[model samples]
Target: MELIQNTPELSAYLAASDVIDHEHPLVRTVAATLRADASDAYTYAKAAFEFVRDTIPHSHDIGDPRVTWRASDVLEQGTGICYAKAHALVALLRAEGIPAGLCYQKFDVVHGLIAVRLPGEERWARQDPRGNKVDVDAQFRIDREQLAFLIRPEFNEVDWPVLFAEPHPAVLQCLQEAVDEPHLWQTLPTEL
Candidate 1:
């Protein structure tokens, strides 16, 4: 499989050592596995996303900040906040040929999720652990009553804010800026 060039957000992420050396064996292992399995980028990306979503338990409470985490951290502890989990997925997807990025939403609290908006696709997909294949796209976001049609009971219980059809304006701006400044991850605020 050919390695697709990193999206601006992904490129910035890889330039940061803290993210690349995120303290978790699973993160490194997953990244390595994706790199090795170059045949099918989409399959590798989806599998990696599923691994993080299903294997790591979600924590409602915000924990200590002193604990710097990577994908490996969540994999080892079997739990993680949404941001870390999304970060891990991003690392793995980028290691492969897939183009992936992070999408931050204001959910009472700021939360981030992994997003893979494949080129030429109108909708973005989200990974649901309890769902059929564990990889679901936003195009499946149905009306309130229609939720049952798209998600399983286990996934329905979690509060998933509606995904925006278009990327947030601020996020788009940041991504544009990143194209010029590849190392912008270090200077930008973590909110987005």
Candidate 2:
């Protein structure tokens, strides 16, 4: 019997890493739900994305001292900053065989989903689950992405890729077992 080789693309997106433990029971449950409910990859991606965005609260947003760095922990704790929430989203999407990675803005990043709105395209959208806002509703699509925070000029923000497989050690360290807001902020990595 010969070993079957996974395509590079499949391997990169689907394989579990330290932070993204897709094999965990919770992750598998989300994957199963996406598979059962969604008819296509795009639909599945949207469902998974919404699940995390709406369900999980940002740690700081909730004033929750505990910070989550792992996808499993994010699900278990139901609170995480943008990075932790993104980790959970990436893991969920990857578990469903959808290609997902981390994308960031300056002070506030786009979390896991990345898209460029094209001229007159209505479907590309994004959202920030960070808070509930009358003006900001959920946005899910590849065409007109609607994220939570508008990139402000005063922020001096930069767009970049932050994590792919695992939470960066520096980030993990910043959030690791933090018990309060002051400690969390004091330890948070600034290089993002």
Candidate 3:
């Protein structure tokens, strides 16, 4: 079941960040390109999600391992891990006036992405722009959630960060500068 929380405080997720960089030219350009002709919030959000998930290949999966942490960098480079991709999605959604935030789950390590407050829905829905792996495809669904993996207590994956108004800085930095795949995977942020 999806956890539903729609407090007035969620509005803070709409702000631009140093990492999210919603005001950056690349973010704006990419957002405009993805959201073209989308008349509704759901449509716009879906379009943005699809673009990020399919258009931007995962840094490691593409055999092009370049650490890009900022939303603008992710948009410009057309690749990133889940954290950077989530930052881009948050920037695009906030640019379009939708309230979006970051959420984290542990699998292999702490993976992250944007949690969108879907149109006409009080609860924020998870929309991971990171490309699919195995049987998982991060998608946009307002009624029920479909994410990469569910948390298992046995793994000590207990610290799930929800409702982050912006991307966590340590995560951004670790991903932004990682030079190789092993290091990237090793550097996944678990602290915040």
Candidate 4:
């Protein structure tokens, strides 16, 4: 599917927001550590993706009750759901001046991921940083997407094509209102 940018300005994807919050010191520090190990933007992007995917345990996966909405909180506490992970990944990518945006998939409920326009690439590649499980092996590849869950059309799951500059209001609203992970899951929007 062709990705559509919500904002015409490419810079919007790179800009810091209250949620993406790339300018946060903790985000900067983590980005610095990842950047130091990476030789180029691609390596850095891959490294960043791997760092979040491998290091931070998906809150639901670990059954952590906390709910984190901001990118810095996700990085600092090392636990978050798919939307929070996507926020953390986007913050890391934008922290390094690489363009990044939020994307989503709809299953029984909404699932979140990120779309990155790598250096010099006009096309946006969506990557799922949702922590892997027994059958879900998400990878950082632009050529062919390595997302966590494949859309099962028969089940009515959909891949939303719009690449958002910030978290969708429906998502952000629920995340913000949720008191804990279980409450968050119960309240998750079924559609974008």
Candidate 5:
């Protein structure tokens, strides 16, 4: 699928903000550590992707109730649903000067992930740092998508193609207002 940026400017994807807060000290520290292991932007992106994917546990998958929306909180508290995990991964990517954005898919509910444009690439690749289950496995790859969930078109599941520089308001508002994972599950968006 072709990825469309909400903003025409590439800088928008790299800029730090309240959600994708790459400029935060913690994010920078993590980026520096990941950078030490990487010789180039793509290598650093792979390391960062693996860092979030392997290190952080998806709150719902682990039966953790805590809700986190921001990138730093996902890193600090160590738990988040898909959207929060995407935020963290995006921040880490941006920290290394990669252009990253948010994207979504709908299954039983809205699933969040991120897309990254390597320094000179004309296209972006979608990645799921939502962690893995014995059943659902996701991987980082640019040539093809290895997202966590496959859409069941018969079930009316859809992939929202419009990529954003920030979280979708509906998803962000739900995450912000949710008190816990249980609360979040009850209120998670069904579509964009």
Candidate 6:
């Protein structure tokens, strides 16, 4: 399916999610500012990714119950654990026409981050919310060859089994649902 890029549609979707609030101001702001650029999808995705990575701090203790904190919270506070930041990134990228999705791996302290694959891209790379850099060639152990095209030389391979031995069942379920139903999340208007 084609990714949604227009502001009204994207904003409506995000507002409905209720994930973007005053706390997560950056997500909303970025979406509004970048929507006017008219740049290619990848460029918008990269810019949004970098902005989130630089803005939020990496922490393992921020989100309680591991799911309550949404992108809005992270954007407003300027600090979030990995999962919250990833959610914000996902919302922003999808608003700009990039085909971004969530992928799950078992991790001990940190929650799974966002993974975005551009159209016609062969590999899926992990998005580091702390660094704001895409590890194009990094391995998460699902399959190297399948992700070879997504690998980035700058990022060290992520050890899947060691990082996430027993993935959270709820998180895995959410990731699956998100990938399966790409259009469920909505974005709101800038005025709202």
Model 2 stretches astray by more than 4 angstroms: 1-10, 108-138, 161-163
Tens digits of per-residue lDDT, candidate 4, 42-75, equal: 9999999999999999999999999998999999
The TM-score leader among the candidates is 4
lDDT, candidate 2, residue 54?
Answer: 82
**Of 2 and 3, the candidate ranking higher by TM-score:** 3
lDDT score, candidate 2, position 105: 61
* Cα error, candidate 2, residue 186 (Å): 2.7
The model with the greater lDDT, 1 or 3, is 3
- Candidate 6: C-alpha RMSD after superposition: 12.5
- Ten residues in sequence with the least summed lDDT for candidate 6: 183-192
Give the 10-residue window scoring lowest on summed lDDT in candidate 3.
1-10
Order candidates by lDDT, high to low.
4, 5, 3, 2, 6, 1
lDDT of each: 0.45, 0.63, 0.77, 0.95, 0.92, 0.46
In model 4, the runs with Cα more than 4 Å from the true position are none
Candidate closest to the true structure, highest lDDT = 4
In model 6, which runs have C-alpha deviations exceeding 4 angstroms?
Answer: 1-28, 36-38, 60-68, 132-192
Task: State the displacement of the C-alpha of residue 104, model 1, in Å, after optimal TM-score superposition.
Answer: 0.9
For candidate 1, the TM-score is 0.49
Candidate 3 per-residue C-alpha lDDT over 79-133 given as tens digits, one digit per residue, 9 for 90 to 100: 8888888888889998888989887776666788678886678666776777887
Can you give the TM-score per candidate against the true fold? 0.49, 0.76, 0.87, 0.99, 0.98, 0.50
Worst 10-residue stretch by lDDT in candidate 5? 143-152
Worst 10 residues of 4 by lDDT: 141-150
> How many clashing pairs per prediction, in order?
3, 10, 0, 0, 0, 23
Q: What are the per-residue Cα lDDT tens digits for candidate 1 across 10-116?
A: 34433323443333455667667655754455556656765766665554333322222355555566654555566566666655544555554442334456455
Q: Residue 41, candidate 3: how far off, in angstroms? A: 0.5
